[model samples]
Target: MAAPAELQAALDLLRGLRERHGIDVVTTAQAARSAPAQAAALALRHLLPADLIWHIEGHEVLARLASGDVLVLGLDPSPRVNGRAVREGRLRRATIDEGSARAVFELAAALWSNPKFLPEIEPIGTLMPPPSDALAVPRGMEFVSAMARSDRPLPKVVDEVPTPGWLAPGLLGLAGPRRQAFERTVWNALRFLLLHELGHVCLGHLELGARKQRYRMIEELRIRDGAAPPKAGGLTDEARRALEIEADGFAAARLFGEAHERDASTGLQAGMLSATASALLGAALVPIIFHAMQVFSETPEPLSTHPPLWFRADAMMRAAMPGAGTGALLDAPLRHWAANDALQRPLAAAGHTHPLLGQWLGPVIDGGLDGPARRVLAEARFARDGLLRGRLRVQQQVVPSRGP
Candidate 1:
């Protein structure tokens, strides 16, 4: 099914569940105190659309929602808030380069076009980031804490901006004359995120009252009967699983639009330059292994959350051949998560109660969360002369040019 159509189906299911279960939902950036609410918020938020009213509340949250307003509970800032300010060296940089700007525009456009990505209903505003000097910039930072409200709302709720942490740094770091590679992948990630959030809001999965009330009622009934009561909906294992898969589908379709198959042939071309550059750098590291020990080696698990180190290498292999779809291109990094030792260990620790949860948590748990395409750009080297043809050749390994 079309991504938009599928998104609508998911929303319909959520709305139906809310009506049956009886709850008033809202979407917000607030942090919920209770573990259940936190999990619900996390899962529900992914299902909501970009535009929708989110009522953030803390004290008396469920009661407020039942009375009418949806209570959005914003989490307090991290306690480690070292109020101490540190000076950062000023570096004047372009707010956007041609390639990066184009990429952002495309991402926004895709989200706007896809119902699943943007959702049918949502709150007004765009998802952008706070300014910072962090190396990864907007991509990794929890930069999307605020939203921009729009006066006109109907078909679309949130006015999304693809200015998150990933786009800027990815664009800045790429080596090619044209930033075609970074643009495509960065836009894909942005679209995926926007649509996932929009799903929750549109679906009414974030509603209040009914969820808490049902939980209380279930417990009360169980006490009276001296037997377990049937489970109510909302935040159930099935619900969370459905929502995650829905978002993944939304992201996948958005990345590989309707005509993605037709355009699949170009995958190799997009990564040719990027692959070559990385291979050469890797080869260069081999020679200076001892001297460049620090540079050559990566810090072990917990420090790195990006997909496996070899992910890009695999992408390089796939991109060297023709007929790889956006899905295949994207899978290179996901495979890293699948292969992560940290994630496997956790599944064993948790007894794998939920397979879907394990899959979702793998990336974050194993520190395999890095975006492969974006990372390539983040590591791209800019030639001083900026030569059109003087770029280094990166194959499986970087080999020096044979001819003079």
Candidate 2:
């Protein structure tokens, strides 16, 4: 379909900006071949209203793209792992870097290739109800065990693995059902990234951001004229953080909220995992991607625009599975992070074990929650109940549920 007038206008503006800045933007035809682009198309079909058209284009820049009333999302062709939604006048642009998609596949490959992390990565078969005969396949742990016992060398860490294009086969030497499972996990993670950006558009965040920009511009002009700036007025830091959380909630609900028992069987047959499994896997991988990208430190950044990665991951799990307790949802990611961190560090280094492994895994071994994990759960619960519940309810009333 041809782009809508407003969306095309926004694309033209983006085109001019890129040209003026000497940045090369990918052609639409080229972008359509990308995994992130394909994921955006599938997601938009379900998440967008029929009348609300959108377009995808790739860029060379590594920065997150912005969105507004117009819906022309951008994707970065580079391999850098990052995704975000920003504000552009009348344009709702959600940019996902190709690196982010590659990171998802790499993380899955790393976990699946390792014997220790197999159980954590492949909880679908064991944790969930068993699949029917037709959907049955070797569990990840089974495959890893076979590989370990065989002459084939186990898959290496991210640095050693020969990275393939997004969603390409032979990722870390995985194939067949195992490969499909990895691909599904990566695809769902991309969907979550896109959906988060769409959430900003759906929740009218572009409008709110535009209002703030206008206020800032007015205040700047007042200051330029030597007039005393009035009391500060615009989106506050707290509100910005709240919006990030709300967007996370929106994306989680849309991706995993409507999942049903049938999805396990049906999704497997269709080369997808159950929504619950997808949610858990995506949650585990997203933080890993963020850490790899150096987007933020493990510790909280008080002045940062987004919440801490752990906090965002916890918030997403809560939104996806509100009824479930804080046990595996948070523990799974912490475990995966610990394992990944261990593999990344020098083996001979003293005190090399991931701190989280000691803190989180020790408690899991003892059959209880740890102190820091408990504190994070408390904060996530408080935010969900106190800040997000009412806002989400109102947003749902205005935004249409995704299509079947």
Candidate 3:
């Protein structure tokens, strides 16, 4: 069956934008055959809000991009990792690089498939702090770091490293239930990435920026007209940080809503637990993805737009599982510890550890500590309230004025 005319036009607009951005947009027929595209199709079908439909020029277009509406470009060799959402007028489109998506899936497979990381008989316990010599570097850190940070093609990088048994043969080699489970993990991770971008669009971050810009122009005019100098009336650095955090919260809430709805409808305890676990895992990977792409720093920078990766991870957890105490919040930190330890084992056996791992592992591992966890929860609360107010102020300014 053919797509409606409006939906086809929306897809065409997305294709043009992908090409303009040099993303090597593929034909709709070709995209249908791509794995990443298929994953995206499943996400759009199951994850997107059913009630939401977009209208362009009085004709309805699908709210989210249908499977092949945008290009699924191959591995991005550039430093920029993860998917991006672009807006052209009322239309918003998102695209994910196959390379980054593959990297995330491979990481998940490396950890999940390995018995050492996730034992079948028992759950991994809380982790202790790294030893004093931890700074000396673990064994396989070098190879992992190179694979993560190198601009070289991902396949080439993987080939250069000694293939570990865990990740060997890559994601494709798995079969039966294991493959199904692996695909779910990848889709969960992709869902988080896709929704995070969608959060920016839905939350009106771009619109907020425009409002701030217009406010500044109006304020400047007032200042030049011999009126008292206008106070700061634009988005500040802190405000930008807040917007990023808000988007993370938005994504987390959407994930939680989906899980909750599924659980409610099915009324199956096992299915509910599995869905919840997958949602948490997806949220936890958001920070790891940033770190792997080399976009995240171990410590927060003074002028950085986004919060530290750890903080964002914490914020998402708090938002998704509201009212949960410190004990509940420990899920993410524990998962990080297990994943880090698992990945390290193979690398250490190979006599090298990733350099990037050492940088963030200390703080992330420490996140399991009661002191740090409490501090993060408190800080996240304060930040969330402040940002919400800032966003409200922007909305007020941009709202159309009512006639007197």
Among the numbered candidates, top TM-score falls to 3
lDDT score at residue 375, model 3, on the 0-100 scale: 52
Clashes of each: 41, 8, 10
> What is the per-residue lDDT of model 1 for residues 1-404, given as tens digits with 9 covering 90 to 100?
22455444434543454466443343343323222223334433333233442322231011112323222212112211000100011100001112121223333222222222212122112323222323221222121112111122211111233335444443343334233322333333333333333333333333311333422111101111222223222223222323333333333333334223434444424322233222222211111111111121222221121222233323322332233333523223333323423113322222122232234233333444446534432232121011113232111223221222
Top lDDT hit: 3
lDDT of each: 0.27, 0.43, 0.45
lDDT digits (tens) for residues 1-404 of candidate 3: 23578567766775565466654533344335445445544564455455544432211124654533321212222222445555554455544544445455555565444334323312222212222335342321333344444544444222344434435444444554445545666677777776666666566555554542421111101111222212223444344555556566667767766765665677644312245455665566556655543432222322244556667654544444423223322123322223333223222321212344435444543345445545544444344344455543442343112211
TM-score of 3: 0.58
**Could you tell which candidate, 1 or 3, scores higher by TM-score?**
3
Off by over 4 Å in 2: 1-11, 17-24, 28-68, 119-172, 209-237, 261-273, 292-303, 322-404
**lDDT-sorted candidate list, best first:** 3, 2, 1
Model 2 TM-score on a 0 to 1 scale = 0.55
What is the TM-score of each predicted model, taking all chains together? Answer: 0.25, 0.55, 0.58
User: What's the C-alpha lDDT at position 167 in model 2?
Assistant: 19
Report RMSD (Å) for each prediction in the order shown. 23.1, 14.1, 11.4
**Model 2, residue pairs in steric clash:** 66-86, 67-92, 67-93, 68-91, 68-92, 70-90, 70-92, 79-99
Pairing residues by index, what is the TM-score of model 1? 0.25
Residue 284 local lDDT, model 1: 16
lDDT of 2 at 379: 41
